[model samples]
Target: MEDNGNSTACCVKLADALMSMACMDLQLQSSIHLCASDNRLVPGKPLSPGSTIISDDGTFALGFFSPSNPKKHYYVGIWYNNIPKFTVVWVANRAAPITVPSSAVFTLTRSSNLTLSDGNGHVLWTTMAKSRISISSPRNTKNISTEAMLDNTGNLILRSLADNAIIWQSFDHPTDTLLPGMNLRLSHNTHPLQRLISWKDIRDPSPGPFSYGADPNNLLQRFIWHGSVPHRRSPVWNNYLLIGKYMNNLNSTIYMAINHDSDEVYMSFGMPTGPFSVLIRMKITYLGKSNISAWTTLYSEPVHDCNIYGYCGPNSYCDNTDAVPACKCLDGFEPREEERRTNNRSFLLGCRRRKALRCHHGNSFLTYPSMKVPDNFIYIHKRSFDECMVECRSNCSCVAYAYSNISSGIIDDTRCLLWTGELIDMEKGTMDGDKEIAVKRLGKGSAQGVVEFKNEMLQEIQRLTGQQGSR
Candidate 1:
């Protein structure tokens, strides 16, 4: 009887200890679940359809989202948490959406990858293939982990927990919106550039026709393209730093800046950091329009039809200074008679030169001040004003040339642009000041005329300098 009682007592103690351990394990798991709810995802913790990971500041949220129209296909995306409307900034599975939203799971694997898998164990999207995460672990033991977090600036970052190094981020893969602090790379020596591609339509988040990025041929300017054709073009970057500034109603200054390094040149915009600072974002819509949003359209591209690229056609310029912007031919050109007669003022047929050039005879250049230099120019480096003129004059194929001293704090260089063929996409009174000048070659076959014109240009330069000094 004593042995039996001792055995029973031992069994009871063992059961009680096991129960205590079970409760402690449950509590630990409960704490982990709570921690996962707040802005982060660790290994083995997956985000479901209804659940979301909000940013630390509650400014943005990352979760599954379905566009309003179909309401059937769901995608993992990041959107504004503070705003009333659901404005998605980035999408993870843009091309592949989940049909069964409830069965979709977004997980951060131990390999430091963010993956979205469906009910049947099919991966709709993953960061594993795109990024290579190097996690150090003990010999024969795989215990390394990673986490994904939504940042306050609307960036979704995947980082390794072992060393806390960022493996991948959503800012580098923008869909259609350009949030503050995000950059549009103008030039890079190695890394592939990113483009903001508009969604297919209002209801679909797939790729669209309109896309915006830096011009591959020229890094000095950016282009918004409709398929392969340029829809709109931004003004060339003359200065290496601050491009423009805007003053909001709250008296905060928003600045657009271009930054350059040894290997890269990128453009970004930022506002003052304070309580008065409002949420500002630039989005390219599906309808091929770019808008800066701050509860209102602060800035929009293609403000008028004249703002479109090559709107007035080749050999002509859009004159925006008038009450109604009009297309006008260059100084030594005239609109084609047939097209002008078809639509009296449209000038869609472009223009033709008034006379033909004689290469053997010397020519004089007609200078147009305060003009936006034409497109399709050949850039010549490290050339003086006289040298640029001689370069153009010597080349019989060169039709025109423009030279400017583009000496800024970051770059001390000159812009010597030579045009061999017909000039395209010129604008008048567009530059802020007398910054851009376009010189067109005229068929004046006199050597004395060329020398006299050069002297006149020198005198004009001195006069402009004197006026600037007075300022």
Candidate 2:
């Protein structure tokens, strides 16, 4: 009976020991769960739903999100953590959204790549497994460890723990929003350009119909495209470093600069560097509008619908000086269909020259200051004003010529643009008023010098005004 009692005591001791171990295991799991919510993501650790990896500064968060409530689709995206409005800046699985949000897992793999998997262990999205560093030995490559980190700049980066070299970064592959410090590549001699593609809709993170990027054909300008067609065009870069400047609520100046290098050209914006710096972003809307928004709307390009590319058609310009911007024919041109203009129809018919060009007979150039130069220009390098005029005069097909002194140290000192055939996509009195100089072809006797040209144009304008007053 004593031996049986001892066995029972042993059984109770074993049960108590098992309970302590179970409690310790649960505590370890709870600690690991807390660590998973921090900025760094190590290999073997997976981030599931309801858990987010925030940036070190707590400015951005990376996690699974469903755009709408009754959640049918969910995507892994990075967004502002501090802001009340959840604004996603970058999306990882844009093309493939997970139907089961609860079953989704985002993990950094042993191979130094980030992988997103669905419930059934099917891979949804993965970072390209590209070696950023050269491995001297094959064995060393296998031993290299990696971790994924979310940065204060809203960039998700995967880096090697061995050398801390970046294997892949989300900033290199942008979505709709362009965060400050992210380069929008304008021109590259060899590399393919990157574009900011809009979301399919408010509820869908898939690529939409609208895209914003540099014009492939023209390196000096940018375009907002609707599929294959240009929806709007930015003013040609005048080789100025500062393209845009604005002020925030804090009275800090936000500067957008276009930087040039020997091999590439890119546009990037920056806000004041401080602890109280506000978030600034440029985003392309699903409907094809480009907006620069802070807490409130700061600026939007092509402010009016009439500012759309080719809206005024050929041989015309969009006049934005008035309260409501409207299309107007160039000085020497008139509407092709007067009836259409009067009936409030579209200007797709464009404009026609009031008189046909008679080459070199009595041709003179009419200066239109503060204008946006039309598209499809033939750029002539290093030409003086007189030389530019002579070159245009020599060509019978040349319709108009514009000359400007860039002197911005990166580009050519002088810009001599010659236009032939029809002129398209011109604007007047916009933000780039100082950069453009539109000179039109008119009647007989070209001016010999800049002073002479301005004088003659002034007298001609006064004469026209006098004639109108008398009538």
TM-score of each: 0.81, 0.82
lDDT of 2 by residue, 175-274 (tens): 9989987888878889789899999988888999999998787666789999989999987765554435445353555566677878888777766564
lDDT of 1 by residue, 260-291 (tens): 76788777775666442325777888988877
Best by TM-score: 2
Off by over 4 Å in 1: 1-36, 129-144, 272-278, 360-362, 408-412, 429-434, 443-471
Please list all clashing residue pairs in model 2, or write none if there are none.
362-444
Model 2 has an lDDT value of 0.71
The lDDT per prediction is: 0.68, 0.71
Question: For each predicted model, how many residue pairs clash, with residues at least 3 apart or on different chains?
Answer: 0, 1
Deviation from native of the Cα of residue 78 in model 2, angstroms: 0.7
The numbered model that scores best in lDDT is 2
